[model samples]
Target: MKEIAKISGIAYLMIFISGFYANFAVLESLLDINNPSITTANFINNHSQFGNGLLGFVMMLFFDALLVWSLFGLTKSISKNITYLASFFRLLHALFFGIALFKLWNIYQLTFNASNSVTLQHRVMKLLLDFDTLWTVGLLFFGIHLIVLGYLALKSQYIPKALGLLLLLAAIGYIIDGMAKLFMPNYIDYKDVFEVIVIMPSVIGEFSFTVWLLIKGFKKQRGLQNAKFV
Candidate 1:
């Protein structure tokens, strides 16, 4: 089990890095800074036709898939106490990914068709809004899963408790941010601290945890390897 956990964690971590980098680097680079919305709209209008953005879209699709895969591996590594919850969360994650994939398809249509018709743009915009709604819900589920999984890790002797604690804190921040975004649009601008407090720590903690898991695997402390789900 310990060995499995280590290997799985490493895989998850690698995919996480790949997905995030593709978005932040390739996708973001393609966007125009000055007129982000218009530029993105145009990009969608243009490349989406002959699948110009196909590569990027596929890459983004893989991100969610990787996330789901990682979560599954993480859940398997942990105790069985929360196995059901973990599975549930993974399902939610996959659902969100599906939603995102559909949205991307719509975006492809909007971009390639280039009708420049207000009605079409409005329809695409509505689809985009629906995608955002699903994404936000998925985030909430993801956050909850992390918090619970982190708690499990903290209690276990296999992984470091500090890493688990950091995950928990990060989950809190995500939940808060999601709630604010959903309920209070006006408060969106004030979430700088929230983003910093949650995102940076999470990236660091998860990165460290991933590295450690890959390199050191898990310890045999407290007979964790053979223990049944508590």
Candidate 2:
């Protein structure tokens, strides 16, 4: 159980860092709405950005596969059905992100084929937007996974109840925010509020989990009785 916790924690941190780098260092730094050519220029000149961004998603898929299965293994004794369902949702989220990476690849290909044309620049920008939309779709599955995981955590005597509650709050935020983005035309009007109400909870929940898992690991107790570590 300790070993599993350690591995899961490490993977969690890695996923977080990779995601941060991809979003801020690569995308935020390079992408410009007014001059999409600058974006293309960065992709062509500094291929490392493209490579790093793609690698982050790939690493996420790899680590997430391990993380989800470990979670299922740790909590399945609580409810095998629910554990399986949560794992499935998480796996689906990974699959969605995996497909989204190809959209990035498509953008990269455009850089090589056509970097100067204004129409192509507009197309690239649109593709970037689409990529973000696709990632949000994946987050919907992630939200479901968190909800189930939170339930299992709360039910498990071996885990902290507060952590479980935080997970649930985070799940609610993610689901609501993702749905609003997809369905609500006026989503932009309330985006900042949504970030505060919904996204902040997720960050707190996940970060707390990561820290606890890394430092303390799962609490060993009688409540963990019958829980399969392997």
| Best model number under TM-score | 2
Best by lDDT: 2
| Candidate 2 worst ten-residue window by lDDT | 221-230
**Candidate 2: tens digits of C-alpha lDDT, residues 43-114:** 777666777877877787788888887887667878888899999999989888878878888887777634
Taking the tens digit of each residue's C-alpha lDDT, what string does model 1 give over 1-230? Answer: 46555656656565566556644554445445344366456655456332534454455455545545555555554566475676577568657856765775776666674654666656666665676677777778878877877877776666678878877876787688778767886765675776686578667767766776777655544655543456
Candidate 2: the clashing residue pairs are: none
Quote the lDDT for 65 in model 2.
82
TM-scores of all predicted structures: 0.77, 0.89
After superposition of all CA atoms, the RMSD between model 1 and the true structure is 3.8
